[model samples]
Target: METDLLIIGGGPAGLHAALTADRAGARVVVADESFSLGGQLRQQTQWLSNLPGQYGYGKKRGTWVNEQLINQVGASNVQVLKKHTMIGSYLNGNIGVSDGDKTFEIQSRKNIIAPGAQEEAKVFPGWTLPGVMTAGAAQILINREKVLPGKRAVMVGSNDFSLEVARQLNSCGITVEAIVEEKNQIICSDGELVKTLENVPVYTNSTIEIVTGAGEVEHVVIQTPDGLKEVNVDLVCIANGFSPILEPFEIMNCHFVYQKELGGWLAAYNIHLQTTNPSCYIAGNAAGITDFGSILLTGEIAALSALEAMGFISSAEGTEQKSRCWRELANLESEKVLQARTEMLADYHQKHELDLPDYFMKIKGGKMYG
Candidate 1:
C-alpha cells in the first residue's frame, strides 16, 4: 500500500497523529495489533487528567476520550487496519505488516511509531497463579470484558494508576484488601489521583514477600515498614508501572539513549519528535513516560513534523503549531520529565553535531548514561 503517512498504533497517540496528518491533507493509514482501536485506553474506566486543569477543574473518562478519538478518526479520510502488526522495516523504507494471515508492505512518505508502552510484570512467589495479573489486565477484565477478576483483591502499588484500579475494582463490588508501595510515600504524579482513595488503605515502604493460594491468589504477605502483614484476598494486581515498547523502533534501526526518568531507553528525538531516522517519528508513552495530555500533545507535534517534512504544510506554520503544543505540554508535564526531555534533545544534537537551540540547555544533575 502507498500512503503519505503510516501510523503504527491505534491508541490515543496514533489516532491523534492520524487525525492531525489527515487534516493536513495527507493520506494516513493506522495499523494496530489489537482487534479494535484505543489500545489500553479502551480498558480504562477512571477519569484521566488529559487536559490541563482537568485533574481538579474538570473531568474526562478515559473511555470517553478514547471513543471520541475513534469517532473523529472514523469521520476522517484516515484508513485503519485493525489487527495489523508491523513486523519489520525495509532499507528502502517499506514497512512489513501482518494481520495474522499474510504479510503486506506499506510504503509511506513518513511513519509515526506510537505503539505505546508495556506493563512491567513483577514476579514473586505465587505470581504464576491464574489470578495474579497486572493492574492493566484486571482493568480490562472489569471495564472491557465486564467480568470481575475476583471477589477480593490485594493491590501491589500506590501510584495513581494502581489507586484508580483499586477504585474501579471496589466499584465492581470487589474488596481491595490494601494497596502496597515500595516507595517511602505514595508515588502519585499528582495528588488529585488519591482524592477518591481516601477510604482505601495504603502501605508505604512495602513489598510483597509472597503470595499463597491453593489454585489462585488467596493470601498475600506484604513486608511493610512495620513488618510482615498478611492479607486475605482472591486476586493480586501488580501495578509496578510500565516500560516503553521500543522493539518495533529497534527493528527500524533507530538510535536510542537511556533516560531512566522517561521509562528507560527511548529513541533519540528532537523538539519536534523526529527520531534519528529523519522520516520516522515517535509519540505517546513510546516516546517517554508522561501525562495523557502531554502524550496527545507529542502525537500532534510528531504529526506536524512529518507533515512539514512531506511538504503538506509550510515550515513556519509547523513551527508555530509545535510551539503552541510545547507550551501546552509544559503545562501538563512534570518537571522531571521536562528536564529529561531537554537533556535528551541536547544529547541528540551534540552527538550529531547539529546546532542546538539557545533555550535548550543541559539540565544540572540529570543522569545521562548514554
Candidate 2:
C-alpha cells in the first residue's frame, strides 16, 4: 500500500495526526496493535488535569474524546488499521506491518511515529509470580476487563499513578493494605487524592524487597529506615515508570535524545515536530511522555508540519495552524509543571530516593540502555 502520510500508531497522537492531515486533504493511514484505538486511555482511571483549578475528566470522558476523534478520521479519507502493528520501518519510506499471519509493506511520502510508551517492570526475585503486575497492567485488567487480580493488594511507588491506583482499588472494595513509596515524598497532592490517602496507609522510605507466595503473592517483605517488615497481601502492583517504544524509529534510524524527565530516550524533533529525517515526524508519548492535552496538541502540529512537507498544504497555512496549537500546548505544559511542583512539595517534609533493586537496574540498562 502507498500513502501520503503513514502514521504508525492509533493512540491519541496518531489519531489526531490522521485527523489533521486528512482535514488538510492528505491521504492518511493509521495502524495500531491493539484491537481498540484509545491507547492507554482505555486503561487510565481518570483524565489528567492539564489546566489548574479545573475538574479533571475521567476514563469515560477520555473514551468519548477518543471516539469523537476516530469518528472524524473515519469520516475523512484516512484509513484506520486496527489490530495492525508496524514491526519495522526503513529509509526511503518503506514500512513493514503485520496483522495476524499476514505481513504487508507500505511506501509513504511521509511517516509519523506515535507508538507511545510501555510500562517498565523491573525483575525482582518473585516478580514472575502470578499476582505481580505493573500499575498500568493492573488498571487494564481491573478497569477494562473487570477482573480483580486479588482481594488484598500492596502497591509500591511514589507517583501520581500509585496514588490513583490505590484510590481506585479501595473504592472498588479491594483491600489496599498500603501504598509504599521507596521515596518518603508524596508525588501527588490533589485535594481528591489527599482525601483518598487519609484512609489508606502511606508508607514512606520503604521498598518491597521480596514477594513470597506458593503460586501467587501471599506476603510482601518491605525494607524501611525503621527496619524490615512484612505485610500480608495477595497482589503486588509495581509502579516503577515508563519507557518509550522506539524500536520502529530505530529501524528507521531516526535520531533521538535522552531526556530523563520525559521518560527516557525521545525522537529528536524541531519545533515543527519534524525529526532529523525530514520525511518523518513524531508526536505524543512516542515523542516524549508529556500530558495528554500536550499529546493532542503535538499531534495537530505534527500533522500540519507533515502536510506542508508533502506539499499538500502551503507553509503559511501550516505555520498559522502550528502557532495556534503550540500556544495552547505551551500553556497546558506550564500549568502541568506548576501542578506537579505543588504536589511534590506537599510532602516535602518526607523525601527520599526511589528504591529500585539491582535486577531492575539491569532491566533498565538492558532495553533502555541509552
| lDDT (Cα atoms) of all candidates against the true structure | 0.85, 0.74
Q: Give the best candidate by TM-score.
A: 1
Query: Could you give candidate 2's per-residue lDDT for residues 28-129 as a string of tens digits?
Result: 999889898878876665656662112244333565566677677767898988899888764455888999889888888988888889888867679999
Candidate 1 lDDT score relative to the true structure: 0.85
Q: Which regions of candidate 2 deviate over 4 angstroms?
A: 51-60, 334-370
> For residue 186, what is the lDDT in candidate 2?
68
**Against the true structure, what is each candidate's TM-score?**
0.93, 0.86
Cα lDDT for residue 345, candidate 2: 23
lDDT of 1 by residue, 285-334 (tens): 99998777778888998999999999999988987787667766765677
Best by lDDT: 1
TM-score result, candidate 1: 0.93
lDDT for 266 (candidate 1):
81
Off by over 4 Å in 1: 50-57, 189-192, 357-370
